[model samples]
Target: MWARRRAARQERLDRVAAEAIAEFEARVSSMLATADESHQALLELRELLARELADINGLLAPGGGMPVEMVRAQLEPGDDALAQMDRISAEFTAVRVQVIGKGAADRETLVPLLEDLGGFVEGMGELADNVFGAAEATTELRVNLQDARKDLAPLRARLQPALRAAEDELAATRGAPGWHVRQVALATLGDRLAALEEGRVWPTPEKTTVDLYQELEHELATLRDEIAQTPS
Candidate 1:
């Protein structure tokens, strides 16, 4: 009877973990898409500015072989506009570069988090296998599994701060088109990952483990759907 109950619980655990994975995957996809769009938008802005500069330079060209100073005189009137455009372009370029760098950093930081979560999920799978494969599962083995879960908790917790920072940075730059969608995706990913970490870390009974896991699964599923619905 206990074995049957354990099998049922394992099924539930697997279901939740699968749901969480689906959600995390979707959010990551959304973030990458946003980064791509932002990059293209920055390129367009640069191209437009370049075209304006070329047009203005042509207009200020020396006519009738006028003196260089005379050409300079012709250009002086619109110099402020050129300067302002230069300044705006520089600022926009900087923001674009920063956003790209942030995206790369976010990916780097998230890799470890994903690995850590993978470990937790793997541990759960192994525990479930052992529980079912054994002729009879022992209390001692269950205790050891609990200890393993605890060990995994601290590593997962360590990632929360980094995850929070990535989310915050992503959110701070949401004024641009498509950026707001990415911010939402990043925030959702952070929250889901944190919940997974918490599910492992919480000092709860084995019986309650499935409940925590299922809750995280539900949260992740919702996040995934929301991300999919988010406009690019």
Candidate 2:
């Protein structure tokens, strides 16, 4: 009877321990999901920045008042967030292996790691905000170009040509993969542009709208450039 009692107690202890680990892992997964969402936002912002700069490069006249070198300078802020995310990704993978992948015991150390990760996620968001004068990099570039032009009438008129150009590219390849995403980006960018204020007080966008089309335009675009590269 004593032996059976001991076995039952051991079994209960084991089950309780397993439930604890499962709870811990669920918490960890939720936290890491936040990072994944943030990382993707950084990626889309980086790609959009690259595309807008390239677009501006295409639009500028030779010896155009703005040099490509000048236009490209804006990418600096967001790159750090991307680099930090890469490091976090590696460390996160290692932690995940211990907590969930191997079905191992939860480490007391991981609690500290989780706190640090949460902090890193917050910092990355702040860094991304520095790069966004608006949702897509398009309006940021537009404002830069507008500043050089120094006239709202001409600048406002020029505001949407790039957007129209992007839409036309997607329209040409209707029903193609990533087409829907490009369409959403158009809407996001348009909404952002319409939201622009007269004082040009560029608002810092929420860094967590990973829910936005920015990333969904997944397998996505530099729009015209990507579409051009796509073989008919």
Candidate 3:
């Protein structure tokens, strides 16, 4: 009887200890879950940052001048960057898994890992914000400038031909258009002609929009002459 009584007491003690351990693990799991949330947030932010940086790099490359929104839309599609953020968040969920796998007795071993994960999360968030913000700013500026250039195109085209024609007529007439006529014509043509001469004009394929076609042809002939003179 005494032996049976001692066995029962020992079993009760073991059960109590097991319950204590389980409760401790439950608390740890909750804390780990919160940390995982933060880690996931940081990973998402980093992914978004990387994606934006890539987009801006592509935009800033040679022969690439599309608007920011358009480029962004093309990259992200319907769900946009948010979808990518979600994907990154999911990818970092393994941190939570790792922490949750720790036993009650493993708290000492697990705490440092959880802390490191948190630190990594904070660092990633900072890095992502910095890179994304800079690239976004640069891309926005470029897009705005491109939009302004687009707005100026029609005026540039209309004014260009008239200015070139006036300059040509004045040149052909050997400045004989008289002092007042010459002054008025040159003044009227100066702004647009100067802009053209400075190469601020937009691209217009063929000779259709340009008054300097014949002049360009002459220049091309001169270039051919120079090439011909060079030793083969």
How many clashes would you count in candidate 3? Answer: 0
**TM-score rank order:** 2, 3, 1
Per-model lDDT: 0.47, 0.57, 0.53
Q: What's the TM-score of each model vs. the native?
A: 0.29, 0.47, 0.43
Worst 10 residues of 2 by lDDT: 207-216
Per-residue alpha-carbon lDDT of model 2 for 48-140, expressed as tens digits? 765665566564544332333434455444445445545655665565454444332646767877776677677668757865653355656
Best by lDDT: 2
Stretches > 4 Å off in candidate 1: 59-108, 111-232
What's model 2's lDDT at 187? Answer: 76
Which scores greater on lDDT, model 1 or model 3? 3
TM-score of 1: 0.29
The residue-by-residue lDDT of candidate 1 on 175-226, one tens digit each, is 5456666666666666655544433233345534334544444554554454
